[model samples]
Target: MQTQTKTQFDFIIIGAGSAGATLAARLSENPEFSVCLIEAGVKDTSPFIHIPFGLAFLARLTHLGWSHNTAPQQELNNRRLFWPRGKVLGGSSSLNAMCYIRGVAQDYQRWSDAGAKGWDWQSVLPYFIKSEKQQHGASEYHGDAGYLCVDDLRHTNPLSQSFVNAAEHVDLAQVKDFNGAEHHGLGFYQVTQINGQRCSSAKAYLSNAMARSNLTILTQAHVEKIIVEQGRATGVQLHINKKTLLLKANKEVLLCAGAINSPQLLMLSGLGPKEHLADQSIATIVDLPAVGQNLQDHLDVLVQYRCKSNVSYGLSLAAIPTYVKAAYTYTFKHKGMLSSNIAEAGGFDKTEFAGEECDIQYHFLPAILQDHGRSNALGHGYGLHVCALYPQSRGEIRLLSKDPQGELHIEPRYLSHPDDQKVAIAAVRKAREILAAEDFKPYQAREVLPGAEVQTDAQILAFIRANSQSIYHPVGTCKMGLAEDPTTVVDENLKVKGMSGLRVVDASVMPSLIGGNTNAATIMIAERAADLIKQEHSSA
Candidate 1:
């Protein structure tokens, strides 16, 4: 490895995604601390990244995405799932479906119970409020003034409303807000948007901090490994512009590289399981057995239906004129089909088999989405995505080789547990119930996926195995827990166990997956992590 001149900073953060962007921006707020943020992708300057409805186009743009695929799964008929992660300035927040959900109180309580002390709902609610800029103003559960914008969809499609009506017809309560007092109700999901545009973490937190002299942001900087010396994280080795450079961190080195990359980076730096590192010929520095275990994600299956009317967003030669008019309308007023965030409405509900908490989450898309919107289907259709919130199966991220640029092995082990399969079957039945409600009589045509013949539990299970895909919420690879726990990678303060000046402040450190989306909780993690870093420094 060719070495270039070294640069020093008080804190160095890897992966400027949802968590890193927020951490770097927050840490740089104090002029006393100099912060450096490194991103493997380029700037978030693409128009598709800024527009609320442009996620479909951004999802396929390989340059802006780290399009990683999972290892073949034995449970899913040996199928490898596609995982799209943001490689831009704002990270996945710039490429995600703008939905803003912070999950339920029980989720954080489970974390605290599992050794993530001080991360309960009450302890972390302040950080959520501190990072939010809710459009509905301040409340006991929300904030009015913050960097991240949280607002209702600018324009809701008629088909999306029909889904909401159908959900209500099936005995589900019509909730106006999902992030309110209760989470077990069907409703329209608020999103991370501002004036019909995407308000990503880079836009929310990093934009204001860019002009600050104390903060330095580097784009297209691929981090090779964390530099650990004598059981302390001292710096990071990055490959930028075809050259190797060492960046020193005087105080701390934070890993905010999400679940997949965070664990991969740790292993690359010889901080993972001893056996796994030995297999790859990498020297073990920490011998941490839980660097990439306990992988959890929302495995979703889509139940699509053909729409009788053209009200749904779908590709057709007859809709060219309509699309032209809609484009014109959006160009002037920013309100029309163009402003719709396809999956405009969704909700949470508990099944009969579920406990007091909701086990199934829904995302009603106005358009027929398949393979993460990468494939094209015929005719106009609408779809409802059903995902099991709390899965029992666990996966892992293993190093393919010692080379940092080599592909990392990601195995989600989806539907490995028998209970998860049962929940999947139940969620599909509930989705079919919602679609067959009286409110959807006018729009209902016929079920496209699974068809009407696939009714038996065995048939539904088979369909779930064939059609289920990730909803893009991967977490718990580097779990935070009690020190005595062998699977715990970090402690309650997010500091890596058996190591000093190294912490993980992202979804990877989550002891367990949240009941809802991971983005909001990730931002909250960074907010609290900033406070923890400051407290440690003040005491020193």
Candidate 2:
């Protein structure tokens, strides 16, 4: 077999997801540096790709989604839960519901306290605002001039309004903004949309820089391993069009391949735990035992209720006109329900756990989200998803085989901890309580999922263990912190500690998952990492 030719770049970024795209675009701003961005998936060119309401059609889409599955949870009778991550240009940001949330201030403060220097809430808040061009007027915490557009939801169903009112009725204080100084109350969700289309990472960051001459983007390029030499990372060995190619990095090689792939790539390149690499007959370059450990994700329980009125998402036929009106508003005037995110409203609140900050987040939907693959709603229905903000259940990603092309074993171990299950149960109970409030009396007809018959805590617990699923927030596999921290994969500067010329700039570096939607935080991390890399380059 003939070996393919080699290419070189000043910086090689793997995976053009939320972080990778933003990092590539920002770093390539200076025409002096050459950047190569490789994506395993194809371009973001589908007509449905831009539609805000089309994400549901794109959810289980395999061509544009990795559609990862966890190694059956022992707690849930060994059920392997499906994990769908975007494999296309924008990554999960492309396939996500597009809720734009920055999470609580203390989430970052915890990162700084955990040895991630300069990553406290105060220091990182600027990056969040800098990346957000809020449709509303600018505040101290939000900016109006940025690449990513954050717009208010346009077509909120009456069912959604009733849910928010129910939350308030249940004494969950009504909050105007979750991203503001206080993040403990019910409020409307701000989404990543401009006009009626999704403002994905490709549309937000990559589109603006696509015409640049110094940047080369290769799609359908599956990287097999990082080509590290003499303890210094160089580039990657990738398979494109059934041919192997060696791409070299002149300055640095950044891994934005996400949590699962970043760690998997490291292991494939012999940059992981020594014994584990040796077991697979791969020479160890770095004995980073914590490379694939410390994995965390938010498990959400969807508490669905049937409505008395004909105001549920089941009215898709009637809602078509509303969606049309929204499309018209955006198509002509750059506003309306077309701009509305499917998850129109939500909030953050605590469970009276005596924590300094809120530890629970809710995604209030105006439709029945009870069904896993599909739904059969009898009448107007809505779902209130209760998600545990911080999880203690740590899972790990391991290599299934020595070959770089082999599938990785991801054991997310969801609900492994009794505390996680307990918290989740409590959250759902709270959701049920909220559903019982008078605010919902106007719209709600009855309890559907748990049903009026199943009222005991034991019954709810059983239902929870069987039905709870991930909200798609996965992080901490390649955690960032001080070198001494056993789980730390990268330093405060976002550089891999035991390696040179390599950095992990994605959700993988998050010490823990944020309080709410992680897409915004992932983008912010890349925005900050870009500056960090630039400063390091300047000093060199």
Best by lDDT: 1
Query: Model 1 RMSD to the real structure?
Result: 1.9
Clash count, one per candidate: 0, 1
lDDT of each: 0.89, 0.83
TM-score of each: 0.98, 0.94
Deviation of model 2 at 147, angstroms:
0.8
> In candidate 1, what are the lDDT values of residues 459-537, reduced to their tens digit?
9999988888989999999999898899899999999988998999999999888998899999999999999998777
Q: How many backbone overlaps does candidate 2 show? A: 1
Ten-residue region with minimum lDDT total, candidate 1 = 1-10
Cα lDDT tens digits for candidate 2, 429-491: 777777777777766477777777767778888888788788898899899999888778899
Clashing pairs in 2: 312-380
